[model samples]
Target chain A: MTSTLKIGDVTFSKIPRVLIAKPGLDGHDRGAKYVAKALRDAGMEVIYTGIRQTPEDIAAAAVQEDVDIVGLSLLSGAHNELFPRVVQALKSRGGADIPVFGGGIIPDADFADLKRAGICAIFTPGARIDDIVREIHGILES
Target chain B: MLVRRSLDLNSLASQISGDTVLEGVEPWASRVRALSKALSLLENDPWLATRFLQHPALAKLSTNARVVGLTGLPGAGKSTLTNLIVGRLRKLGKSVAVLAVDPSSTDTGGAVLGDRIRMQDHFCDPQVYIRSMGSRGALGGVSRATRGAIRLIGLLGYDYILVETVGIGQSESEIVSIADTTTLVLMPNSGDDIQLMKAGVLQMADVYVVNKCDLSNPQRMLSELRANSEARGRGNEWTPPVLATSAAEQQGLDEFVDALQKHAEYEHDHPEGRAIKRKRVQTEIATNLLFILEREVQKMVAQVPDAEVNAVQAGQLPAMVVANRLFTEAFAMVQQGKIEKNST
Candidate 1:
């Protein structure tokens, strides 16, 4: 029955809050939902905003929820425009320190620009759930 | 994230002072960030949050803010109605903070806090602050962080605080203990009026809103709610007002606001007015104490070594012995330091 987590010196015993959102017109939530369920199973409180969320809404919700991490999933090929916009929005809302990671039909060529845009990490279709959870914990730990 | 400091005024002040927004400036995004960060402390480390709540900055907070609770069945448009109410309240020049609660999965402890989805209109408005909360296995609709968040919102000088419960239907009675006015939002043709009337969560509301009035048979539903609410009225006591609304069509909102104001006046003028406020304070105190104890227990459980757990599972160590050892350490830690600042 014990679900608390401890990493390094910090005990993530308090459920780490996370937000997984969709920031565009695409309604494909299978990926986002899977990760959300994964994170929840990993004992984190995950907030999922169904679909068609604006960047400002996502960032505002993240800051308001006081989430430790934010995960965005988009498949409309608009990651170039929207991912950085979400990062920018988070920064404007004083959430620059909140790690921004993403998933969906993103290409390998787009990774560097997106990272420069402030997306800390990206997960593609073949990415394992364990890797996502490990990467997120690593992000939170750092 | 760990609550990284002792949260004395100097520490909290320094935490926010690092931002460009100077101190004493209340109307800025940094203020929102500060409010949010405090809530994180409340959620992640309640032991530290207790110290923050006791700080001088919170000691002098204004006690005038009105707390309204919106509760009903899920998908009953609490968020849409709350958005409309926020729009109306802002037009009346009143600032509002909404704490929308969503249930965590008992299996996974994750939640898809979708209530804020409908409230996109007020996302960027400085006068309106909306936060989504996960229930985290706490029953009675709202999350455990709710009471502390209310205090933080009150400290930030919001004119009104809206608490949107998880709306588990029958058991969400805790709203009555937290909000000065509880608005029960219901849908039409649900037969909930007569059925849920005996269900207990239906009786706590100071106001009843049969939202989505555009649906078929809404008038009948409204009349049913009115009829049921009228039967609960006693001599000279404040009878809950049952109203109808179409949030999409923007109907019945002004009357809703007036009804809320009227109920507030009733509470303020009631012979036993202090009873409601006293109940709310009691709930807050109980929740804070629970938060501290539960968090300490979680920390202790996390610190249990794999060897001990394996020994217990293998029947090498008795469960009671292991539990006693854990409790002993947790109690000693509690005695040693009430706030484990920088333990992260």
Candidate 2:
């Protein structure tokens, strides 16, 4: 784990950059802030787009920051509308291959719909920090 | 199973150089996409990044964009001011790009770039492009990839480029060389006057902004800034103007915009000011060239005999002597036209 993580055949010389954004009008940033800290502690560069960011803002930041992964955290029950828009925007902005994941108050019922919309994975409330980190490694390594 | 697609460097370069295009997307529609891809390539692949930057096509695509560097201490409302400035410039129908550099963690070389949060209102605007860059262990508060990003944005036809450095003080003189006008933002009652003078921060400001004017004691801070500026004795004719603004309240932004316009005009009119700009550009070019040369030298050093390094490590030879020998070998390699071939 101390060695650089490889996404594919290419080995990165620098640390992986992860863009963690809060989409929609969700005022709660405790979750996003915690995850950002976790990723930083995991030896990844994390760019946290502050609260209430539109899908466009998140996508644009993803491309401009050149991040390896985009993590969306939402608590306002607008995940269905906002998360897909972000994935679409990232595709349009030449980041179609970048992995997208989420963690928030997303319902268990919406997991399939979110996955269909191109979300790779989702973490519910009370998820372990080590599990989230392991999920990231598994996703990137795949 | 998840599929992972690797980056295609050749295709990315072709798109950036306009030699190829994705079908169904118009040339203009693909420009931003291509630029984004090129920037990512620049960050990931050093050898390709060097080749892409030194491409002859870049020289042909010249732009007259003005690059403004905004810097201050943390929580000085730089992002707020930047958002206001972007709004003003967009109102005037000018295309703007903002490159916000955030500090990297020294231990992990990671950063949480959150500057885009304050400026998210402009996210949907096609005329405004905002980017957050990590300082990436750069001492000057700006990322090395930023120069390439600026050049790419300029080529994409941006009229103004605003570079917001990690709230840095004093020794970050690299901003002065990178920016056409370097603005130092200060907050009221911050007790920054002594630090400002000690760090030679006063000399770096082409425009001093007292942001959060609605807060306590802005006038006092403004007067202190003015006094310090006057005492420094400028090497040029233009005196940096101290302007006040409350970005949160949206007051004094008009006057701040006017001051920027006037500064631009002054630089255009004065030969001395233009000479200073030229010198800055020269310094930037020299610095980048040295960086490239250093990489080449490192490559040559890697090929040196391990016995030599072991001798130095064992204290059998002075480290400086081994370094000198490596430099001499690197110099010989450079003379043999081997350096040019090393750009893979």
Candidate 3:
């Protein structure tokens, strides 16, 4: 529970407390909930903020909830507009150090832009649950 | 039981000490981040949480915030009502902090806390701070960290602290001692009058709100609750008011708030107000002591030999006797050393 903990086979330098939120008008949350539950299963505390959240709402929640990572999932293809808004909101609100992660139907062409917009990691569809968990742990470790 | 790396409490304390602020700018956003980190410590690390809670800057905070706890059955609109109450309080220029508790998975000890969904309206408001908590196997509709979380929120200078409990059923009414004002939010037509009387949650409320009035008229339910209130034995001479509110239509919200305000006034005037606070401290101490004792017992049990376990399993030694012996030995160890390790 300190800066580092070893539980079972996994040793984390920092146990990740994440916020899995849906940004934009999309209401379907199969991917968000799946990743949320997957992270929960991997020994993480996930704040699932449910569907149709604005970037500001997501940022406010991430700060107030004190999460180290904000995971946004959107299938509406508005990731280009909404995802960076989340990063900008955080920067304006004194949470610039909190990282943002993306999941759900993002085309490969948009990956670099999303990364440039300050998304540390993106887990597309068919990304294995173990791989997603490993990537998250890797991010926290770095 | 776990020795965590200490946080920079001296630095955090210097920031929260409101002594230097007669007329100066406040670091509101940084305070929010500090509160979030403090709560995370409370939830995940016990040793550090005790130290943080005992720091003078935090420990010096008087109970200035009016803590109002809302509890009801699931889907009874506790979250929506909380949002409405936060909006109303902010309109009155009162800073608000909301602690919404959800249940944890019994299988994996994990939780998906989603109370922010209904509370998005206040997320953008700098005056309102909301945090969702996982119950983490604590009974009584709150997390083990709630005692510490509410204290931290108070220290951060919120005027109103709202604690929304997990959807509670009968007998999960620990909110009685956890809040200064307890409101039970029930939906219309939840059950018959007889069933309502049988419910354990019915007896412990300072106010009752029959929410979602747009779907059904609450006149019948109101009359029933009035009759029930009249029949009950009066303790402090304050009859719990039963009011109706519709979040969808925004009806009777002001009236409900008025009732809450009136109740607060009544409690303030009564000497029993301080009496309730004393009882709350006693209850919180007992709950926390039991939690710590459970941890110590687990430590002792881990050291028990397999032959002792085999004896118990083979019926040669009673498990109750072994438990009693373990408790005495472990508790004596705590009496000498364990408390010093964490409290320091």
Candidate 4:
């Protein structure tokens, strides 16, 4: 499977590491686990942080892990309270500019609001696994 | 079913101390490397899917993750938008999971398999979980197993689960079945604006995004959106805001986040709406599960004694009569087991 993907004359077989964390009190993990497997299949490193984390803790972990991308899975309807705190914490920790993306039961009305709060991208459930891998590849390569 | 030693949920939660693996055995930084290695192995392995489903790691996540869904049309720039949003969300100190679904080829019955190729920006990031699913001719343009996978992600304790679909179409309607919110992505120039209004996509719009604002005719598109909104008289109540974004340029992302936050507040204020939505979700799940179980049971019963089936077919007894007899027999067995347990 790794041999199937080559870019610019490079095999590009290494899997990228992504830290998938749960923040606050949201409790939904099936999507996250399936995605983790999908990414792994795509040949990327995946660090899954167990649920109920604060923005500060997540940022610190991202820093410690030296991760290039961070993802939040917010489903408890706390994107408003949690997203900003995560962004602020990341910035304060000198980890600003790291790409942050989120998706979960987020209403269509709230998608824009989340982006404005510093979320780089938003994905709803209808998203394909290939598209996600493509986005992660594009973000890391860029 | 193999029953492993069960760890009490309360005990695990209290004793685990931290979600992170016990320190020292694997340094947090190095653990990222190990995780990457594991992912690579899984990606290259043909049996990856089976092993993943059987992994013990999942048992720990009884509750602690959020699964999200994103659906749109082929050219809706879903890949681009996912990159833009996931990037920002990660920087904000959140671990993200993305399940981007792709359409299967009409000819080969296989997926085009290009999503991972297109999204390269977060390729090496240790914080993002990105995966793709082949529709494989599933109705609604998503895999049926995708729901079970979403449940697994939630149980594993991910903070956010993002499911991005191929794009807006009748098939995209499945997002409503599995996602808390479904985002409909559209381009202004598609000339389907009015169609979108009529097709119920506009009604599904919690946040309507018009991508490619940098184009010369973005405002023209916005005007059309405004006109359409006014025509519907949707502004008097909560108006779904239209945002112009250029995923390629990484523009208007902040405004997008803001809109999501505001809507979250709105949902909180209206519990009735939330309740209605949750009930629908629960019913959908129950209906699917029951349907599958019933089908399997019927199949199994068909192989039972032909004498019993023939007895009913002879018209001497009604079909319902035979069904009732079998049901009662099964019920009696269950009752007998319960009685024995109580006696013990």
Candidate 5:
């Protein structure tokens, strides 16, 4: 009774691949590393680009990885500088439809700003790890 | 077609799982080029990602390097600014890596990968490494796997890493997630500039620069920026400082660098800020993972027979009964695999 159906080519996958990268120079990657581990444990494919990536590089990798979700981890205080660039590059590269989400030391008030700029969710500090994984699933499934 | 293959995937998995050091560091120059090629292949080949998901380096990369995002409106001179920042950081005796996000090649699913070509001065300089990425159909305007590339850069021992976004309005904001800080660049008197302002530019700004300051009406635009900031008030403990610069002339950059240094120092001193940053990371990971798991479960359940579904629908059986049965079967499959591993 339970063996005859299939969901897409893969079974109940919430983005099988993740492209994780840093956008600019602030040289702190502890947060990104932790998140990669969390995502990997959750059974999603995680490609963690350690540090110092351009938005183009990140976007290119995301496209190459055929990732369902694009997760950017910024601690350089330069998210404002890098987010839009990656977004635009992705859009230009025809990846404007892939779900893009991110987290970092963004200020509280800037949360809405990041969203309006096109990020699905901006998880500031204090956001639960479970919440992050959940949001990735939510964004992809939706 | 996607069933377990003959090759020992488990062996490959075990190879990249722990602290086993991967060799071939010295040929990083060519290795990075190959890495880029492999990554592109993974993007086009779904099986590639599935196969490499177990690679230890893919997930176990370090976090010691700086992650920066360089953003500005089109023609706001981000390329010039990137050159300047990289140049300055180099003069300060820091090794730099630039992750440039560019448009993709439609035919091959690859990027032109041309940012390095533009920054030719640093090409011969071993202190700098530049890599370009294509967005490749990601929503919210950036690629999904940007962090992975950044991690690789850090692992290579670069002191400072820079990310330059493809500057499009609104959608460009995904950079906030990957950068420690973001600098928003603008120019005086562009028609669409007002549109961006009204679209909530103030909040996306960690540092605001009125680029092309050498152009006319710089003061008036600066005043407008100030007015906007004043209206918003000093909302956070760290007030985003506004500066004027001409990326073409390379003027006012030292002050910008100083301001960036000051903000970096402030973040270091403020334990609250650090805590907040950590919290953001935790939330992103947890939320995305759960989302994926639930989706997988749903897919698994969809494989259930229609009669079983109808039985639940008709109230002959509880929905939980169906769900539990499915989960149990799935877990059993997993358990069986684990047992097989132990036996092997």
Candidate 6:
């Protein structure tokens, strides 16, 4: 499900930074780590916030790191609550413009709800790394 | 699609200035939001970063925060030691901020910034603020943006600011000018004493820590470090003490911290030490100005006629003559306040 989603009109002369975080009590980090590595390989500065970060922690990190995108990998079924909380946290901190996306074991039924909660895109199981990279490029360029 | 709200410089600055927008009852959360916003602005906008340094609020900010620089080779456990120090400082109720500078990919200008991962133990602590900055094609291990970041963190009321360099040898001397105390972390059995001499790491260190002490005999390295310090006769007053630490095992950190404190105290008590710090700041400001001038000069040169550049390239014109002509024109335009208009 690809759509045009630019982070903002803010231009950066340096490499764009992306903060990939696991924002729930999910011990599974293989997907997060893989995406982080792929993003770094794709020439974006990637700061990986290790697993089990609270929404506040993720938002704070996203701001402090000055990330262009905040990517969350939540394998736990708590995306319904965790995802929106991160978006709310970013918004409260005056970072509403920062693009946020997620990937994990999310159910198809919750896609619209998560989208409504401010997640730009959601990658589920078997999402190819190249496709993810292309999607990120598309989003940033849009 | 996410709702698009335009973020203007004024609103961003207001968010960063700790004004009415951040006057929440919860001090910690509010401070975090304000500081994060300020740093985010500084990181993304070079103009804001420069203006922040010149802002009057910066003069009102406390300069008492000890800026400690940690430098080492790639595998020397600098981040582990930094994490340990952060834990120790937080235990004493002191706030700490870390600026971890990682090397940028020369080809792509990207970085993985994995140092923060090693220091993730403090991720949940509000008192600990860690930001990873890429070297961004700077020759020095630390980037130009670091000094501004340090000043901003100082204004954030942190008691200590630790700057971890890119771990490149020789070029790491830049930290000595910026940090009040520069600690060189080394692992035992890493190399011979000659390598240290060649890197001039001994001359740059205020305190040396032989990390990974549990792995090998550190006494030999320690004694050699001391002897080298003595041979250098650092400033004819203070001799850098070589301590040992096993960061993984969490041993010898107390002595290391004590040594750092003693150095900080010595710098505080001695007038010459203070003068030296002042001198370093003066040099830093001068260097930054020179860098700006160089960039401006490059921009002016880019506007030089291609025929003139080709003439110089083809040896039909002397390079120094062309440079002199360009400098004269640029200098006159500057005097007339027409440089920017002419350049464009």
DockQ, every prediction: 0.25, 0.27, 0.30, 0.02, 0.02, 0.24
Candidate that beats the other on DockQ, 2 or 4, i.e. the better one: 2
Assign candidate 1 its CAPRI class: acceptable
Interface RMSD of each: 7.4, 7.2, 8.2, 17.0, 15.3, 8.3
Give the poorly placed runs of model 3, Cα more than 4 Å off: A1-15, A24-30, A41-43, A50-52, A76-78, A125-130, B1-9, B15-26, B233-236, B299-344
lDDT measured at residue A81 in model 4 versus the true structure, 0 to 100: 81
The 10-residue segment of model 6 chain B with minimum total lDDT is: B1-10
lDDT of 2: 0.79
Residue B118, model 4, lDDT:
46
Model 4 chain B weakest 10-residue run by lDDT: B1-10
Clashing pairs in 1: A48-B112
Q: What is the TM-score of each candidate against the true structure?
A: 0.79, 0.87, 0.85, 0.52, 0.54, 0.87
User: Which digits, one per residue and each the tens of the lDDT, describe model 1 over residues B61-154?
Assistant: 5557899999988889998999899999999999999999988878766566778777878877888888888887789888877887887777
Off by over 4 Å in 6: A1-14, A76-78, A88-97, B1-7, B22-31, B55-62, B233-236, B328-344
The sequence of per-residue lDDT tens digits that candidate 2 reaches over residues A51-88 is: 88888788877876677789999998999999999999
Off-target runs (Cα >4 Å) in candidate 2 are A1-14, B1-5, B17-29, B55-59, B192-196, B231-236, B300-322, B325-344
Docking class of 3: acceptable
Candidate 4 Cα errors over 4 Å, as ranges: A1-142, B1-66, B105-109, B200-202, B223-238, B297-344
CA lDDT of B36 in candidate 3? 77
Report how far off residue B3 is in candidate 6 (Å).
Answer: 17
Model 2: fraction of native contacts: 0.31
Q: Distance from true position, residue B121, model 6, in Å?
A: 2.6
What is the C-alpha lDDT profile of model 5 across B163-253, one tens digit per residue? Answer: 8877656556777667777787778764433654665444666677888988766877777777666655354466667789987788989
List chain B TM-scores, each candidate.
0.79, 0.88, 0.87, 0.67, 0.71, 0.88
Candidate ordering by TM-score (highest first) = 2, 6, 3, 1, 5, 4
What fraction of the true interface contacts does model 4 reproduce? 0.01
Per-residue error (Å), model 4, residue B176: 1.7
Per-residue accuracy of model 1 over A12-130 as CA lDDT, tens digit each: 24567789999989999999989988887777777776699889888888887778889999999999999999988888877887889999999999999999998999999999999
